[model samples]
Target: MKLVVAYIRHEAFEPIRLELLELGFPSITIIEVKGSGRQKGITEQYRGSALTNYLRPKIKIECVVADGDTQTIVDTILKHARTGSIGDGKVFVIPVEQAYRIRTGESGEETLQIHPDAAAAAT
Candidate 1:
């Protein structure tokens, strides 16, 4: 298993989501977050004054998928999230030791999938 975490601009969320769903990987977690990277934030003007906000908002997308799906998920995020802008955000892949589904006590990849019929219906 692997964990794919991506911090992306708000504008890219919907497209990225749809792409993942169509790819049959719909299990994901979304979080609204604030942070900054090499872009170092942006400067804005208010009341004839300049204000710099170091933290920008990003939507964090987290997915625990099968190891084989890691690359595809990252590629999908890149395809949808890029805007050629500084604050476009980042993607990280991490090793996952294990995973579980409390309801059925299912573990590993079994817990990360949707029934084929259900997945197709969703798309």
Candidate 2:
């Protein structure tokens, strides 16, 4: 299995989620995060004061899929998340040693599949 982690602009979350769902990759975990990379954060003016080195808000989307689906998922995220500018964010693919569905004790690839039948069986 592979875990695809994508850090994307906050505004891109909904579009990315919808695209992923259309692609049959509906199982995702989203986290609101703040960080900066090559863009090195940004400067903003508040109350006539300059706020420097402020971490930008980003959405982190994590989806674990069978190894074969990793690239497709990554592409979907990139397509939906890109804005032709810096701070557009990045995606990382990590190898998952194992995964377990706590209820049914399903492990490995089965743990990542999202299906009504499978979910019911897991309980």
Q: Estimate each model's TM-score.
A: 0.90, 0.88
Candidate 1 per-residue C-alpha lDDT over 8-100 given as tens digits, one digit per residue, 9 for 90 to 100: 999999999999999988899999999989889589999999999999999999999999999999999999999897888999999999888
Clashing pairs in 1: none
Best by TM-score: 1
Q: Where is model 1 poorest over a 10-residue stretch in terms of lDDT?
A: 110-119
Top-lDDT structure, candidate number: 1
CA lDDT, every model vs. true structure: 0.92, 0.89
Cα lDDT tens digits for candidate 2, 1-123: 999999999888998889888888889999999997888857888999988875888999999999899989988899888889999999999999999999878888877777568669979
Clash total of candidate 2: 0
TM-score of 2: 0.88
